[model samples]
Target: MASSSKCAFLVFLCVIVLLAPSEVHAKSMAKAQGGWYLVEGLCSKFPDCNKHCKEQGFLGGQCLKLGVNMLCFCIHT
Candidate 1:
């Protein structure tokens, strides 16, 4: 029983270590791609970000046409 518990713990630690890099990379990518910052029930788009959406350009102008609530929350500067 003790051996099995140890093995399980070791496996869990190994999984965490292996997955950590990908998780960090994903977070960095999201930051790099820009993200919605929540502030007082308002979501603000990162306009001065290093990355921009090539399809719609910026969230302030055309992406506003998607849905009223979502556009309001996500498109605010």
Candidate 2:
């Protein structure tokens, strides 16, 4: 019984570890010169980012993929 419990615990741990990272991730632009930061968000197309970017008051926005997910990048001055 103790061995079975251990196995179950290990399986649970494995699932958590394996699926910990998501396919899509949102991130800010790195080292954007002139105070430009890359904004990241989940998206499926270019327009999807426009609203989000406008809300943030960014100069513009664009959609990009970091892994398996589409992210919207809002560019601000």
Candidate 3:
């Protein structure tokens, strides 16, 4: 009766707790692919840059420029 209902409720709560970690991991993956979400969400309140720093042509000089731009943009406004 009442005791069984309480047990069932406890089991439901335990199931929800078990599922919570998966939900958190999924959200983290989503954020990683979507953008620099956590940093922007916490700090200067925007995603840092759209440019990719690891591209091939960027090694010569372009990445340096992009990096500078990103730093300036992130720091100033």
Candidate 4:
């Protein structure tokens, strides 16, 4: 019974190892599909970021709070 449990654990570990690379690759692929750019200034509000991105000819923009800094990311197709 103990040997069977150990075998099951090993199988589970192997499955995780096999799936890890594909997951990482998928994330990278998604990032490559629609590019993201860091805007020049801090994002005080999402609407302002969106407007800025539109003016810059991007599809849209989002304001992300990283620590104390509010950063804007412009998205394009």
Candidate 5:
């Protein structure tokens, strides 16, 4: 019974971890008044995306892995 409880707890924790990122992403998207911008160049790091977006007069940006591509999405208010 204890082992089963531990397994259930692990499953619940895994689900939370997986869903947390999406929830945060959705909230960020909602705050993007100027919408998302597809930044050109390789997004090897998150800070690189942020720097590019700031140069373009945006609030900030994030590096997202989309299938075969690592795309940069800039957000602005």
Candidate 6:
């Protein structure tokens, strides 16, 4: 009887271990994603601006001009 109980307990533990990864993955998928961080700097075209931002380890970037120089809002993930 004791051996049977131990076997049952081991099976339960194995099942839990098998199910745990899926639960963690599901939770992570369900959780809200992070927001974008804006990095302000001088820029020219949108492509060049975005490329520079990505090169700087950001997610992407966009150029918006306030005056003479187009301000590059580098998107940092």
Q: Pick the candidate with the highest TM-score.
A: 2
Instruction: Tell me each candidate's TM-score.
Output: 0.34, 0.53, 0.34, 0.45, 0.43, 0.41
Question: Which candidate gets the maximum lDDT versus the true structure?
Answer: 2
Q: Per-residue lDDT for 1-77 in model 6, tens only?
A: 99999999999999998766433311111111365646344453345877887887877767766444456676644
Clash pairs of candidate 2?
29-38
Per-candidate clashes, comma-separated: 0, 1, 0, 0, 0, 0
Question: What is candidate 4's lDDT per residue for 1-77, written digit by digit as tens?
Answer: 99999999999999998766433311111243558554434565445887888887878777766455666667766
Q: For model 6, give the 10-residue run with minimal summed lDDT.
A: 23-32
Clash number for candidate 6: 0
lDDT (tens digit, per residue) of candidate 3 on 1-77: 99999999999999998766433312111123324321112112223232322222221111112221322111111
Residues 1-77, candidate 1, lDDT per residue (tens digit)?
A: 99999999999999998765433311111121255521112113424232333223434322222222222222223
What is each predicted model's overall lDDT from 0 to 1? 0.36, 0.68, 0.32, 0.63, 0.65, 0.59
Return whichever of 2 and 4 wins on TM-score.
2
For model 2, residues 1-77, the per-residue Cα lDDT tens digits are 99999999999999887665453354646556566657565675445687777777787777767565566777777
Off by over 4 Å in 1: 25-77
Clashing pairs in 5: none
The runs of at least 3 residues in candidate 2 whose Cα sits more than 4 Å from the true structure, single-residue gaps closed, are 1-18, 23-29, 32-35, 44-47
